[model samples]
Target: MTGRTPAPSDRTSRRRRAGVVVPHQPTRLQRLLARLVFLLIRAVALTLRRSLVDRTGCHDPLPPRAIYAVWHNRLALCLEAYRTYARPRSAARGLAALVSASRDGGFLAAVLECYGVRPVRGSSSRRGPQALLELTTWAERGYDLAITPDGPRGPRYVVQDGVISLAQVTGLPIVPASYRLSRFLRLRSWDGFIVPLPFARWEVILGKPLHVPRQVSETEREEFRRELQRRLLEITQD
Candidate 1:
């Protein structure tokens, strides 16, 4: 006896059984709180950066187009630095970041909006496909893409395939950047979430652009990934 093809509802049920479900929606109050937290963090970061790291990177304008890749843990300070430095200097070239699609990520999207950073919601584990499509579309429309290669919950600084894949698809150079702080607190989180105290000394490190060729092989991809990981580690090393 032969089995019949499954109905659309049956297929949907099977997918749910495989562990996919709609995400929870954040309440307005929750969003407000998240925005407040984001503003507070941005304020602290800007203040610390002003007193600490010299605005060298910001002094020169950013290329009209480029991909910005930074570590997940360093995101707190990075957001502020990019806006105060790169964005305005680039004459508002505009930046689109890959954020997670989880409910927790809703807050992050809101936060990025407050800073004039566009958020494309997705991650390796969720909404990744849709987000990637959106990112590519935005890139075509002239927005510089920003990605936290190891993010939305992490093994703490491990670079993921998404960054490389995006570079290959978009033919954009991955500009690796990170910052080190003299007096900062590291959260006991997966990414050791770095938060610099106000007026702390800091160094903003920008590495050369990394290019991923369109015809890269599996081995070559891994090599580039390792190289990116090494550069990021070097920048963040205390």
Candidate 2:
């Protein structure tokens, strides 16, 4: 049951494809606010002491490409985490993150731009299929992919199937990553989003990569999903 890669035409005509809503473009005001937020977060992140524990072995020199599966709650410092640990070792030009295709997503997309990372809009809902195709295009162009297995909305730390599907189609390994902050606050969001305080110690843990075979059955995909969930939970600490 090998998943077929979407055809080149699928990549070329993705936006025009039926059922794909055009992603919301951020207005000028939103872009300005995003820059202010980015600067504020950058100042805080720079004050934190950070370290990486790479169980993946790929960190001696990161793989040319692999999907990073970070939990939704741990996203506050994810972009910085990439800049700290993955980017230096990554042979790829840059990273691309899957974001929601809503008005809120527009603001976040602008923030990603400030970090020089590409934002691929769409989620498990909204323009899902189109987003997947667009992500595949990014992968083909040599950008590493990042996804929150449970995100936009969540059942907390549960792993969703979309990451598995992306790996199947793109033939990239999935690397489960999590971080522990010595000081932090949990927001009242569905995922209990973590906001790390400045000047705290941060430990980013990268688990061994999980390779999803192109010919996986649905049952096997579920098994991979659970394995990812377990690894993420295992390495995470409050």
Candidate 3:
């Protein structure tokens, strides 16, 4: 089953149907902070040497597209890594990431724009199902999707149902990815967020793709979610 294209004929109409609210516009201070974060990511990414782990056993090059899953805490580095290594072969507009539809997500949306990644606003907590549907539409429209499953808020490293549902709907394989840094700082955030220092070696893994059966029972969905979480943990040691 291929993913469905969004019902709305145009992007603006789709936004209205989702009942999406425009997040507060960034203040001057917010813009400055976004710039700083943007530069920080660039510098750190430049200093690190990286690699991709294909747990799925396919020896060919990275797939032209995938639903790349990473943890909430690793969002920053993962975005840059994707840009440097995975963005080229994707559709010209690049990867479409699922971001929360909230004030906080506004900040992230801006940073993503800086790096040329497109941010699709919505989350499991707000406009939740609609976001999933939109993501499926994006995947069908040829944009590789990126998701932080335990994100927007988390039970830390625990996978959510949304991603599994997405795979079922999109017929796209889930690629679990994570990175380990030789040196880093773990912020006291809910996910023990890591900010890798410059010059630290960053080793990334793109786990073998896990294909979700389109018509799974609830138990199967949970099982797949846990399996994804387990795969991510396998490559996250730092």
Candidate 4:
């Protein structure tokens, strides 16, 4: 044999091993279900003033091209709130989210797509590098990027470095955001997933935008992460 390496028999297999395969396309039924869910969320959010809080910045009038950082536990309610508040602000600019690379994230991606939210599937602990790269590209393309600072098998409410890294790389301000519900069911899951009961009073809070230097020190990174965690907790705390 020559010194050159032999090519893989299947491109698909090679791609899978390299973690570069295309995501699965949802079926028609799946798409329909996703659409139904999206519509229901929008309807519910629109109907209840108490069920949603939308505290945005003056930056809303200007196109939204920043990074939105939220906690994992408040995901469900936050999704609806974003659709109501942030959607209109960023509709023209486009919005993309960093989802987990796990199978569960596949379903989540489909759901997001139904709401016109593009999913850049990856997580801080899984496929993180690729996800960060994708997010940077999306941000450079003027898409508002959203990330759950504590997500995808979280330590529950703790912020990871990925979000900070993303902001630094994309040169986008990190907007700390969260939601609080007067009545909701909290899942026993790792992140204590929260689901707001219909008609429940909700408060969506947005902290001032935070910026990270592209060449921050490790200490600075950790400090920023801690600040983000504290801000999310302050908004979501009962």
Candidate 5:
């Protein structure tokens, strides 16, 4: 007998089973906390409905895929901004983002799913190669890849090397982006996590795309990384 075609969900499940990367499998307390956090985020997001300022010259016909690089602190808002700005360009295109494979990351993956985004579990220190390959596969399938270049524990706002490698391997331009809020709270977390209050006006900035050539040397890659960091910081407002 012949087997039936697998659903997308099934494929994702298989990837996890095959050790590509796995989402959080929390304990009871953690599960409850994740749910509660998701609720709070949902309430705030719905009430606020933040706005974006498209400076990246990527409107009307959105590019097929540009690796979205954003600061870790701005992860919350940028996810929403990207879904709002890029998803409508064509229903066919989707987004697959990198999330850490940690306990906290498990909570974050749940949150992203709540917002209709696919979360790939991995980080610089865990399953990094698997995540890169999976993200590349997603990009090939027309899904815009989103990554926090400074994430999974950070030196605070410094871009990591993985993103540069990703751009070089995938031949996708690195699009540095961020959102500024008129009113917000800052956490003592390493990335200086910003939590925007409800009804605050948002100024979302999409900086120019930095393309990394396929034949880039190690020195050239670091140069591109610094350039990416500069461009990202340039669009960010204090």
Candidate 6:
């Protein structure tokens, strides 16, 4: 028996499946709460005594563009770290970070906007393809990207394949960065979220960039993922 070619409708359906979906929009209440949270974050960030530990020159003076991989637990200081460290030295003018597409993510996206950071909403569970496409768009515009490999819910410090795929697709180096807080509270959350105490010493550590080849085998991608996980573990504090 001979095989039949797919119909035009079948091809159209496939194209639709590959297309990006619209991101979740924040509700009015979520927006309002986000503003309050942004104010609180701003107040807390200003009182911290911040420092940087960049042995790898990759972040001291950021490259034209790169992907930053930080642990999920250390996200509390991500914006502060960027504003204090990367933004000043980066040749890139904007930062676009991956975020979830849930209701909570809506609030977070708003807070990110408050910091002038663009949020690409999606995650492994929802709108994943759409988010990756959006991130690629931002990258083409010369914006630096950030992703918490184990974020939006996580297995703590474990790195996921999303970051690896992103690095491969964007052809950007993954710079592992983490934080050490002299004084802070650990929230009873999935990621043990950190809340820094007033006037505490906050350190941002950036590791060497791991470049992912544009063409890589599944085994190679896994290797890169493990390498990123190891580097993040090295820099992250419990």
Counted clashes in each candidate structure:
0, 0, 2, 1, 0, 0
Please report the candidate that would top lDDT against the real structure. 2
Per-residue lDDT tens digits of candidate 4, residues 1-238? 6676546546546787886754445667667777787777676666555533444455545235678888887777567766666667664367899888766777778888877788998776667888889888888787888998888777888888899999889888887888777777888888778766778777777776788889999998999988877777767784
Question: Poorest 10 consecutive residues of model 2 by lDDT?
Answer: 11-20
Model 2: CA > 4 A from native: 1-18
Better by lDDT, candidate 5 or 1: 5
Clashes of 1: 0
By TM-score, who's the top model here?
2
lDDT of 3 by residue, 1-238 (tens): 6577755346546676777654344556766788899998887788887766656565555676789999988887988778765665444346888988777787887888787777788777777787888788888888889899998899888898889988999988888888888888999888898988989888877776788999999998988988998888887775
After the best TM-score superposition of candidate 2, give how far the Cα of residue 133 lies from its true spot, in angstroms.
Answer: 0.6
Q: All candidates' lDDT scores?
A: 0.77, 0.89, 0.80, 0.76, 0.81, 0.85
Model 5 lDDT per residue over 87-204, tens place: 6764437788899988898878777776777788899988898888888888788778889998989887799999998888888888888888888899988888899788777777
Superposed model 1: Cα runs more than 4 Å off: 1-26, 49-59
lDDT score at residue 50, model 5, on the 0-100 scale: 66
Q: After superposition, how far is residue 212 of candidate 2 from its true place, in Å?
A: 0.2
Positional deviation of residue 19's Cα in model 2 after best superposition, in angstroms: 2.6
> lDDT by residue for model 2 over 32-77, one digit each (tens)?
9999989988999999998988898665887778899999899889
lDDT, model 3: 0.80
Candidate 4 ranges beyond 4 A from true positions: 1-12, 19-32, 51-64, 89-92
How many backbone collisions does model 2 have? 0
